[model samples]
Target: MTTYTAINLIARPTGGPIGPDLFEVVQKELPSVGEGQFLVKQNHMSLDPAMFGWMSPDTESYIPPVELGDVMRSSGIGEVVDSKHPDFQVGDRVMGMMGWTEYRLTNGVGLNKVTAPLPDEAILSVFALPGLTATQGLYSIGKPKKGETLVVSGAAGSVGSIVGQLAKADGLTVIGVVGSDEKADWIINELGFDGAVNYKSENLAEQLAELTPRGIDVYFENTGGPIQHHVFERMNAHGRIAVCGLIADYPKQTPDLAPNWIPIIKKRLTIQGFTMPDHFGEIPALLEKLTPYVMQGKIKHRAHVLNGLESAMTGLNLFFTGQNKGKLIVKI
Candidate 1:
């Protein structure tokens, strides 16, 4: 009789930072790998801002909330340790929504085999949700053109970094909105973004104005903070905006007032909000568009890894604090 540990959501976040109070850690007996099923030993799991919405009680969200007492919903990469499925082998590497657990027994319904030579961190950072989301939103919504100016909030994050790089590769003038001088410097210096605005710095409007003198042609919004209004003010006519995450308002009891629609009408902006689950069918095409950038060295990534499974209980706070330097992953 072997036991494995798993974390379950017990309560929704009320306010403030996420802590252990919302979760319960329990040990469970490992299940046998029945016929047509395979047992996975999860090696690494992604920690995303999306998880916050998943844990919320909002049934209207793009995906269902993580039910109370259920293993917290998350995507992870693992190796098949025991298998009875004909399609899966014992040493096969697979990734999907395996949740916050050390092990999972599944019939390979949603799981996809990982055949890339990259490590788990790189795979998750670029090829998984971050890369997929970036490609989907940038190509489908942004409609970016060469020489156009593009601004991406949360530019140093997994999705934002990829978005900026892809736009830069396409000859767009990429400007990233980050939270710190270090992140701003990394995006500009390392990721090759044309410019970066530290949202925490003074004179945000002036900095953005100086950088995007031509006006923003494409906006990849990840954090809806003061920077949003500034960017909204400068959008070019017929501009496109891809509304991704709004980490800025996630913690507030009452979110800040959004920018007026007068600008949207005046600018004739194409503002669209999207979630990856809706476009899961288009993953192969998104990958086809993104892989060349990665293969050509146009895409670069970093992983901020936390050790152990329980670290996830508090690891989420890194998103709010802007402490995570890159993609957040739990090395289980």
Candidate 2:
């Protein structure tokens, strides 16, 4: 093919709802692969909460903002259709930060070749950023212990779901806080979580208290909202918190109100915020650790797959609306 399609960030969002107008889908002539580069036909692209942070004018973040007119930054899995590099062969399946393009030309720098015995959706859901983030934050930051009570906010999401499952595997009591009863049921009944709290329920605090009677020893904070406040107040002394993502505050112009800090002091909480970029080097080790769980079905995942690259603009809104039940992916 002479040309391929790509989505480009055209403007910065103003803390309001995102729309297709901020992005432009354009067709461009395919570029030739350099002597050390290869061409990939991107099959699937991931839509994540971090995209909102990348779309904003916040260069002070862990990574730079997506520059205007650039292909909207994303991670994708694809097949190498053409190659001039010895490290990668034609027909090799790989994953990397390939952005929102139908085809990617790369020098094999950041790419990791994947041989998946599982479906593409599962690989993208559990073996990609979501799984790595969950593994790192929970084991590295949360420092989970056997029989400790653990609570996860945004518990139905890609990262949170994996966090709950991993914690459960380690013999910790797992409670997942989600937006709806259906999600609650999925986490508890399907994912084997000990308890699930619907954050939208009128008696959320009471429900959380009932589910975590032992007091939470590890809190995996994914969405910073009232659910976090409820969990924070119930933390045990010396409790650990892995602050992964604040999806609730991502699209807002003003920051959400801070949760009570008295508990942080009284409980001697250890809170740490992390981004996947800083931990990229650890992915190989993480994948080695996580792959066995996935193969054994000790870790499970779901994907809300959208049909085309253009769907990414709307798919991202699902993260904020709590509409997506699992990992969000755009199938190209």
- RMSD (Cα, Å) for all candidates, in order, is 0.6, 1.0
lDDT of 2: 0.91
Instruction: Return the lDDT, model 2, position 156.
Output: 94
| Clash totals in order | 0, 0
Which parts of model 1 are misplaced by more than 4 Å? Answer: none
* Tens digits of per-residue lDDT for model 1, 1-332: 99999999999998789999999999999999889999999999999999989988899988889899999999999999999999999999999999999999999988999999999999999999999999999999999999999999999999999999999999999999999999988998999998889999899999999999999999999989898999999999999999999998898888899999998888899999999999999988988999998999999999999999999999999999999999999999
Per-residue lDDT for 1-332 in model 2, tens only?
Answer: 59999999999998777889999999999999889999999999998888988999987999999999999999989999999999999999999899999999999988899988767788889999999999999989999999999999999999999999998998999999899899999999999999998878888889988998899999999999888888888889999999998989988889889777777888788999999999999998998888888878898788999998898887888988899989999999
Q: Which pairs clash in the backbone of model 2? A: none
Each prediction's TM-score versus the true structure: 0.99, 0.98
Best model number under TM-score: 1
**Residue 220 of model 1: what lDDT?**
94
TM-score of 1: 0.99
